[model samples]
Target: MTIWHRSARFHYRFATNRPVAPATGVVVDLSLNIVGDFVSHGGFRNYNPDITRPTPHLIHSGHGTMAFGGRTWDVGPGDVFVFFPGLPVEYADDPQRPWRYRWIGLEGPLALPALASIGLTPSQPLGRIGDPATVDRLLAEALSGTVERAFPPTRHIAMAWQLVAAIAAKPPAVDVDTVVHQLATGDPAAPPSITAISRRHRIAPSTVYRRATATLGIAPKAYQLERRFDLAQRLLAGRTLPVRDVAAQCGFNDANYFARAFRRRYGVAPSQWRSGQI
Candidate 1:
């Protein structure tokens, strides 16, 4: 049986240094005096608010995959994820540990232009930012509210730019195909089993299993199960079909069993979850 986890209870504080250049004027000053744990245990999807201005987001990982922008990626400790401007992102942790992270939004005239200088764009689904120390400092400061006092608005905005520049300067060696393959093979909506996937790829089951585990850090079957669970969640969110019908369509034979599994994974019954969404 899968034991589920929930997001961490964490908080942060944010304040910006005053700007010297009018071009670099601070457009927004957010204070993260306190923030609830941003990660979700069991598996949950939440929508990101629409944004017209460039905003910076911070993501800390839990023990499971975090889904955003129609892709799922593995997250471990000390990992940092950035979502820039107007894009939607959602995340959830695994059965053992829910996703735990802190994030805030900042939009101003200089944001995108600064990011562009570093090869960072607002449109990509996801990317990492900064070294571990930088990420650590940012989070610690935000959570502890130290940045509010230690840095002025100008300095803070400059720091944000530095972070973006670091991301832009990093080599683009990340394997795009590897990420796509995971989404294609692991998404529950697709429901292609290891055997079926292996055949499709013209490889042995052991080879497929080994590759997914080695590259994705997840056993193939488990990955598929996660994807299937994601599909069920989406169907439930759509509110278009009966939960029993959803269970059948998603390949679970028993609706009661499915409900139990969903609740255990999501920390709420399907009905309750749907209600809360409304």
Candidate 2:
């Protein structure tokens, strides 16, 4: 059910028995529980009823200003904005052209990280949706879940993920360079994989490879290998661990192979290099 509040600006839906889907690592339980369609309020600003939850808004049409942290942005159609918990939000309609928008309230332990994946963080709270129509359609589907009083709002929860994917399909603030950087550095044992990056970012493997090569002058796999060796050098020099242990630490299953690769990289065997015999 929804409450029509023309005076308050929102056709609001109360929270429901929403099912949270938690992931394996860095668990994100973000589920769509509430949504609203906001109409114009002339030029009067409306404060958020609660600042203890994460709320993301999509500007359906018109231009307006969203204020938080003593800063304001002139937002336009297709622009999406979010505010983390404990942050105040205030907005009003554009005088020349009153603005209308939609918002979804997300709650869970890992809601902030979930939003950050789509590039909406406290530091950078606003991002332009590349395909606003897709995002719009998904949100509309979720908005309809307000009337579903069933056990679990599966459709709403599913729509939330689809919406996130659609928004993430576009470059986050037009920075594929940053994505390529993330593709270069990670845990030494588990290096960056083009396949994983392609799948997660919803981009082609060739696109990732091209960006990696263009930015670092080497592919992502090469970059990860170079990074792994940098750690190996540090470990060989600083730690008393044996070459075998070092090999294992660097994700090398065979000592002989590690020695050969280390020799090729440094022009000397790892042991000799460690002993300053290079």
RMSD of each: 13.8, 20.0
For TM-score, the strongest prediction is 2
Which ranges in model 2 have alpha carbons more than 4 Å from their true place?
Answer: 8-17, 20-28, 151-153, 171-278
**Native-to-model Cα distance after best TM-score fit, residue 17 in candidate 2, in Å:** 5.3
TM-score of each: 0.43, 0.54
Over 4 Å off, model 1: 1-44, 63-80, 142-153, 166-278
lDDT of 1 by residue, 1-278 (tens): 11123444423233333334324543443222222235454455455656444544445555545455667655544444445555665655554445556554444565556556544464443345545456556556544443335444344555555555544444334343454375456436445455544433335667656666776677766767787787887888898889898887777878999899989999998888777776
TM-score of 1: 0.43
Candidate 2 lDDT over 146-203, as tens digits, reads 5555424355556667677776666444356666877876677666467645544557
Estimate every model's Cα lDDT from 0 to 1.
Answer: 0.54, 0.72
> Which one wins on lDDT?
2
